[model samples]
Target: MTGNAFTAVIDDTMTAPNIGEPEEDMFRLARHLGLDIQGFHTFGDAAEFPQLQREAWDAARTALDRGLPVFAKELDLGNETSLIYAYDADGYYTHSWHGGKGHEGSDAVIPWTELGRNYCPCSSCRARASSGDRPSDGVYTGDPGYGGFVSLHWASAAEPSDARRALGAALDFALSFSRRGAYGWGGRTFYSGPAAYGKWIGLLRSNAIQSFYMGYFIDLFHESRLYAYRFLLEASEHFDGRPGDELRTAAEHYGVIAKNFQSLNKLFPWMQPHAPIDDPDRRREAVELLTGIRQLEEEGWGLLERLLTWVR
Candidate 1:
């Protein structure tokens, strides 16, 4: 319940706004979830780093050799994480979000030359090609040339759960999600918190809704809100009285958000947020839908903030 779903980030350009990258608070909360992760965010092409590459490769193999799974982010999964379980001279065998061939799960190997970079490191990496391109330059969405890897290892899975402490931390995160949490990278701007909704609306108003990244954003956030609702629902049981009531109400609002996002996902499946939305009428409809979502999220955020006061 680290309140990950509470924030949304996008850039001023409104390109491939991968807002899911958790910042300081989320990382701190990871400890509570029994995950001790070490990572690096690099701003150059990884192809030049043979020594570092070999080190990472050897580490993954060592982890696998010890019957442990190695974790890395933005490894051929369009700004997502991957689980490394096998490796050889060619590359690391992973179970990336983009499964199957061209990926690590069934038949994919992330070459040492490709790991550290932005989303869609190569042509074969993207699950599908978008018919739409940037109107400014007709460029399809591609990596912004930055990359990172977060090596994850199990810390203490057997540790007893601390519902109260976790709830307090999550409540703080949820409350802050609407106010702060801005980020930037590779000369690109990003907006998180409730402001992210406004960024989406702005993009919709621009009438240049990205086909691929837009769709990916919807699919990812929709799923996140779904989990937000479910987690809050379960979180209620750990509390008593008004705080519990407030959490339940907040959860209901998130449920609304999840349902609407599900509908939005259908409108923009996979990485096609601009599917039928390229049309003016449908685009206007999407604007309206996104506007409603923004309002609902803010209302839910308000409830969460209030719940924090009561719980504290």
Candidate 2:
């Protein structure tokens, strides 16, 4: 997902100046995107001198002139995602999410983190974990070196040794925050309520994922047949004594329902505002699409009811 992108201050009074080269890129983009950029950093005669920071800042300003208001942080933190931030040249932040409380700006958690974890060891996590204290959420906020407002997002934990477990945990974390209306990916815009649910439906259709698995009537029937047998066995034996513990069965059952309702999911991708459906006619198209889904849902639910009665 594109993750959440925002502009953050290093502190109460900090503005863009205190940000190093890497951070300057975010500032530059904010300027390009016509966002407010206000932040400060302390710089003086240290061994690193002003050259490195100056070069980075200068380059960032150039990008700002070009109007690209987002940039990734160059720091290496041990997380599964890349960190990016945005700057508002005016330093005045406004986001639909906060309901006008205004944003100081925040970091962008890129999907690339998952990719990055495939290679390196996450240093931030190591340091935090080594302290013999349970770390707060993976979120790294305001390092002392950068003063208070410079927050960092640790790439999720995905190491070779326990990559599977780490990936699962990280995905869970991402999903938790994402569902709060903080992330978007694969050209899909997700929001609250049925908006996200509707987006998933559209995504399933436009991506042609169903064509690969749920296209043919026979294939769906076979799947349902297999699931029915399994479901019956589960019901009879009560594996783990759980309802729907047999995911293979439940998925197949749901998959059948989803396919039978394919037309419902299919209509939205073309109508919803989330997908590549960016024409000015968005609302009208969506309304028509919603009509179709409504019809299909009514019909689909009926089918589900019948199927449920017969299966059990």
For each candidate, the alpha-carbon lDDT, in order, equals: 0.64, 0.31
Per-residue alpha-carbon lDDT of candidate 1 for residues 1-312, written as tens digits (9 for 90 to 100): 567877666766566555334554676676667654444444343353444555666666666786665666545453555666676777766664454546433354557654543234234444343434321211113343432343333222334347777677777876765576456655556677767778778777776567676677787789889999998898888788887888888889899999999888777777563442567776677778888898888788778778777766
**Which residue pairs show backbone clashes in model 1?**
103-108, 215-273
Q: Could you give me the TM-score of model 2 versus the true structure?
A: 0.22
Task: Tell how far residue 249 is off in model 2, in angstroms.
Answer: 6.7
TM-score winner: 1
Q: Point to the candidate with the largest lDDT.
A: 1
Residue-by-residue lDDT tens digits, candidate 2, 244-295: 3432344344344445444433533322232343333543443455445434
The per-prediction tally of clashing pairs is: 2, 38
